[model samples]
Each structure stands twice: as structure tokens, then as C-alpha cells.
Target: MGSNIVFSANNNEEVMVLPVVPEIEVNKPQNNEQFETLNNGTINLIGDEGLRTFSIASIFPSQKYSWLKHGSVAEPFKYVDFFNKWRAKKVPLRVVTSRPDGREWFNMPCVIDSFTFKQLRNGDIEYTLDMAEYRFIGGV
Candidate 1:
């Protein structure tokens, strides 16, 4: 019911809202196994669902434009630092995404797999973040 994509590292209370709604890429692949049979045939078995990956590529504009959505957008480095700190802590973040009409779309615990950014010539920070779903195995 908030921004399109929001990151909450502390407990879903303090959230770092995005400045611009970037492209949220989701990848969920199925885990299947194949074995060779005795008659030169193959047997395929379907496994459980694989963890979904969430990717967001956007730019932090130095100055807020008229079309920007997010309300509270801080400095470019602030966002970079936010993810860096959470990543170093090795904690699972609650990633939430909603539709335009305020409907819950995808919500889950995800870990930051990789984050890359570059400073553009116009003082904007272009970044790409990759995160994977985190499942509690063997009872956390």
C-alpha cells in the first residue's frame, strides 16, 4: 500500500522508499531432474519451486522531477549506503511491491545478492540491485 518497491531491513517498520519506480524483474524457475533409464530413455521429475529473484534498475535523479513518484528521496549515496549496510549485516529484507491501485503484489523475505551503481554525467546515480528469495530451512 506504499511505493511500488520498498526495502525494509529492520523489521518492516523503517523503510527506505525508492525515488523512482524502476523496472522490477522477477524470475522464478522450476527445479526439475532428469535421469537416464535402462532403455536409453530419460525420466523427468518435477521438484519444488525455485527462489524468485527480484531485480530493479533505476536512476536516482539529483533533482526531483515533476513526474517522479516517490515523496521522500534523499541523496544518491544514502541509498547506496542503506543497501551496503544491510548487506553487510547479512539480514533478510522484507521486499514489498504493489500495483498502481494499492494492491499487494509480491511480498517476501529477500537477501541482497548483488548491487551495482555508476555515477552518471548529470549527477544521477544509476543502480541495479539483485535479490533472491530467502527461505528458512530446518526451522531457522
Candidate 2:
């Protein structure tokens, strides 16, 4: 099986396959609350679920190596450029995680909450990306 993680903003016209499988951190907290009732009893309420967030910390390679998981090799700067342009556009980017046979486990449109990267001495770009699920607003 090849890489199962992919990122795209161009409707799959183009995509970037993660060079390695990152240990993703998934979080979606509930807003449960408790309040005091007039009768001196506590009332517990189960609030709506918060947006699910996905965190990824990995390295974008500058050169192809033995462990490279993706099929093609791209300069690290290209990855950075993609993120910069997408964030500037303020549009939801899509991440699709699926099985080798194409059974998807995660397919979400998310806003880029944060993106940070550092160039290491070896020319690899180490990056931390945080994305939050986007909830659609009313449509005309």
C-alpha cells in the first residue's frame, strides 16, 4: 500500500501525497456544562460537539530518500508555497485519508488554523500543521 494521506485545494486537479505517514492527533471536545437549578439541584446539559481538529507534525523532504513514501519527489519549498497560497486564499482545503483500496476513513474540508515550519540543517522542512473542521454557513 502507498501513502494514504493526501492534501489538495484544487479539487484533486493536483494533490500532495504525504512523504510519510504522520502520527496524526485528532481532537473534538464536547462542551458539556452544569448549572444550578432554582430548586438547588444541579442541571447537567450535553452541549453540541466542538469542531474536530487535526494536527500533523512532519518533515517535507528536500530530496528523495530510501524511506520516501510518496511516488514523486518535490522540493520542500513547493510544499511551503502551497500552504502559503492556500492560507492566503482563506478557503477550505481537503484532506483525505483512505485505505489502499480507497475506503476512506477521513475526508474533511478544513480551514488552516495554523501552519509553522523550520528549515533544518539538512534542508528538510519540519512543519507543524493544525487544521479545524469547517462548518458551512447558510447558502443562497
Candidate 3:
């Protein structure tokens, strides 16, 4: 008996490769029409009806008192003095401004010092308003 060996040299095998995934395409608004269409659906009413809802306004007096805070280091005192003036006039005081991205100096502990939780509640506000114009008053 002789040993038998088998060998194949013409064998062909195909290697498969996966296709690449396409990048995401974001369709940004090109004009006001496209912009308004996306935003209009979210709005319900306009004019007086919208105005009837809770309204918040920011007032910059012509002259800030000497006791008021001027720079960022003393901004908290400005908020405090504003509320104090409102209290003196017997008017409710509420604060509404753009939502802060992170821990702002105005939102720090030292800035809100002495104001109790309940008193702080009176300074609550709904949403920040988008003002078309703003004015800062200098010396009294």
C-alpha cells in the first residue's frame, strides 16, 4: 500500500468588505421663511392675548444709588437694592433674565446673602425676555 496525498492549487476565495456609513446631513434654515415655519408651529396666540399673560420688565434707572453695586464684583448688591426699592414702594419685586449657563457670580451664595427662602420666592420670574434695546444709567 502506498500513501496518498491530495493538494489543490486552483482554489479561489472572495474577501468581502463592508461599505462606509454616510455622514449625517443637517438642513439648516436658509431664509426667514424656513426659520419662521419651524418656529411658528410652537406659537399659539399673538398680540393682546400674549400680552395678557405674565409680563416681566427690566428697569435701568437714570442714577444708581451710591449704596448700589457697580461692577461684577458687587453686582449682587444691585439685585438686593432693586428689591429693597421695590419693597419701599410697596410693589412686588421679581427678577427675570437669561438663563445662566453655569454658576454665575450673581447666582453665588455671597450674592444672595441675607435673603431668606420665602423672600427669595417673591423674586421669582417665568422666562427671560429678549430685549431689542437696553440702556445703562451712569451717575445720579
Q: Give the best candidate by TM-score.
A: 1
Write out the backbone clash pairs for model 3.
none
In model 2, how large is the Cα lDDT of residue 4? 73
Model 3 misses residue 115 by how many Å? 3.1
The digit string of per-residue lDDT tens for model 1 on 28-139 reads 9999999999997999899989999978999877777775666547478888888888889887888888888889789899998899999999888999898999997898
* TM-score winner between candidates 1 and 3: 1
Task: Give per-residue CA lDDT, model 3, range 1-140, as digits (tens).
Answer: 11111111112111111011112122222222222356565443332211111212222223433532222122333433544443455432222222124221111000111232122233322121121111123841
Work out candidate 2's RMSD over C-alphas: 2.3
lDDT of 3 at 77: 37
lDDT of 2 at 95: 90
Q: What's the TM for model 3?
A: 0.19
Question: Residue 133 CA error for candidate 2 (Å)?
Answer: 0.6
**Model 1: lDDT of residue 116:** 94
Per-model TM-score versus the true fold = 0.87, 0.86, 0.19
Lowest summed lDDT across 10 adjacent residues in model 3 is found at 104-113
Instruction: Put the candidates in TM-score order, highest first.
Output: 1, 2, 3
